[model samples]
Target chain A: MTLLECKNISKKYGEKEILKNINLSLPSDKIIGLLGKNGAGKSTLIKLINDLLTPTEGEITVKGKPIGVESKRSIAYLPERTYLDKRMTVQAVLTYFSDFYDNFDRQKAEKLLAALDLDPKERLLKMSKGMQEKVQLVLVMSRKADMYILDEPLGGVDPATRDYILNTILSNFAQGASVLISTHLISDVERILDEVIFIDKGQVVLQESADELRTREGGSVDEIFRRMFRC
Target chain B: MDFVFDNNIPIYIQLVEQLKTYIVSGALAAGERLPSVRELAMMTKVNPNTVQKALGELENLGLIYTERTNGKFVSCDSEKIYALRLEYAKNISAEYLAGMKKLGFSAEQAVIYLEDLGGEDFDTSGM
Candidate 1:
């Protein structure tokens, strides 16, 4: 079944159109990479799906219904910026997520926290930038949602920690649920992606299976992206 | 136990090859239950669908079998495994000879070089 579909979606901010007539359908039970360069309106599309921003001239749907509170219930969203409360301890944050999201899994979150070696007593303000990012990702992934939308989950981190984040994202998702991850670091997360959507200037230039793309292009996904979007 | 994919080759093909390697190398013994698709995906850091496709190919090749309500298991027939090992050795030998030929070495010269490098450890295998 289709997990999400955007039909002729367009976004405009005071006459400056960020997205054109975009039509895309994301299927269930797959990990899709949303790839784009900076200022290419990748974030605009993600925000539309998450229902954080309204579309200008089109409609978006999740699981055959319009994106609304019900769609939001089924989608776990992790934005590009940090939104955690700086004064909350790790344990307190866990409680906050559990209280806010009925679908949140406390035990799973605790296990992930332990795997990342994050102390439950440590305050969010004391954690380094990288640690904070990981914590935020853990909170988002610990929910039993039908779809996961992560914006720049791999942005600005060391290579070692990047692998850890990818592993966490892959292992934590429930079976048959879809994950839409927006990222510019193609090579770093290419292995885990089933499909890739290449957005350029608010339009989807290409959407293809990762393996098929590699075979047809005769190069890594990152290499293909560089050739396609080279300055 | 390590899956080092170069990411250029098709991932499912690489996965099938790696699982076959594990089976023939005895790293995954005959009749051993294959890890669940999710577990294998976690270990390899790829989509579960990719791993599922690889496992399906292995089943087609008679390298593994799935028992309903149970799980996937490596083929228990040792003769079948031995045949696979022999075929693998033949492919490796052909490639090795071709590489040596490029370096201006005949079969006899290749043997001599192996002997000079103390080829005693290779005696037990079918060289």
Candidate 2:
């Protein structure tokens, strides 16, 4: 079944259009990469799916239903910016997530925290930016949601930590669920992606299987992205 | 059990090649049970779907087989595996000869050079 679909979606801010007539249908049980350069409306499309921003035209649906409370219940979203309370300790954040989301697995969150070597008693304000991001990832992934939408999960981290993050994402993976990771770091995440959506200037230029793309283009996804969007 | 991949190629093809290498090298011995797809994916740090595809390819090549109840295992056919080892060795020799040819060495000269190197402790660290 299609996990999520966006039909003729368009967004406008004032008189300027942010997204064109975009159409997409993400499949279930796959890890999809939403790839684009900065300011290419990648976040706008994600926000529309999450129901954080309203589309000026067209419709967005999750599991065949319109985006609303029902859709939100099925989606675990990690926005690009930090939204957690800075004063809350890691344990408190876990409790907060468990309380808000019915599918949240507190034990899984705790296990991930331990595996990542994060102290539950550490305050969010005291943790570095990367550590805080790790906490957010643990929280989002702990939920037993149908779909996961992560925006720039690998942004601004060292290479070693990036590998750990990717490993964590794949290790905690549950069958029959879909993960949508949006980022510009194509090479970092390409190997793990089942499919890739290349969006440029508010339009999707290509949507294809990652391995097939590698075979057809004779290069990595990062190389193709560079050749397509080179200045 | 390091499975490093070149991003330019299809990951499944690389997985198939690496697993074949393991099988022929006796690292993954014949009749040894294969790890679960999820475990292999985690170990190799790729998607489970990609790992599944690679295993399917290996199965088609008669290098691995799946039992209905039990998990997958390396093929127990010693003759088939021996044939694969010869094929792998031939490919390596061909590649080395191609490299030597690029440096203006004939096939006979390359063989002679290999014999000369084999007679001494050829340290690869300098290269």
Clash tally, candidates in order: 0, 0
Q: Candidate 2, residues B1-127: lDDT per residue as tens digits?
A: 8899999999999999999999999999999999999999999999999999999999999999999889999999989999999999999999999998898777877787798775555443433
lDDT of 2 at A144: 89
List lDDT for all candidates, in order: 0.92, 0.92
Lowest lDDT sum, 10 consecutive residues, model 2 chain B, at: B118-127
| Stretches of model 1 off by over 4 angstroms after superposition | B118-127
RMSD of each: 3.5, 3.2
Fnat, one value per model: 0.71, 0.85
Tens-digit lDDT track of model 1 for A96-175: 99999999999999998998887899999998888998999999999999999999988888888898899999888987
Q: Model 2, residue A165: what's the lDDT? A: 83
lDDT of 2 by residue, A1-231 (tens): 899999999999998888999999999999999999999999999999999999999999898889999998899999999788889999899889988999999999998899878778999999887888888988998888899899999999989879878988898756788999999999999999999999999999999999999999999999999999997
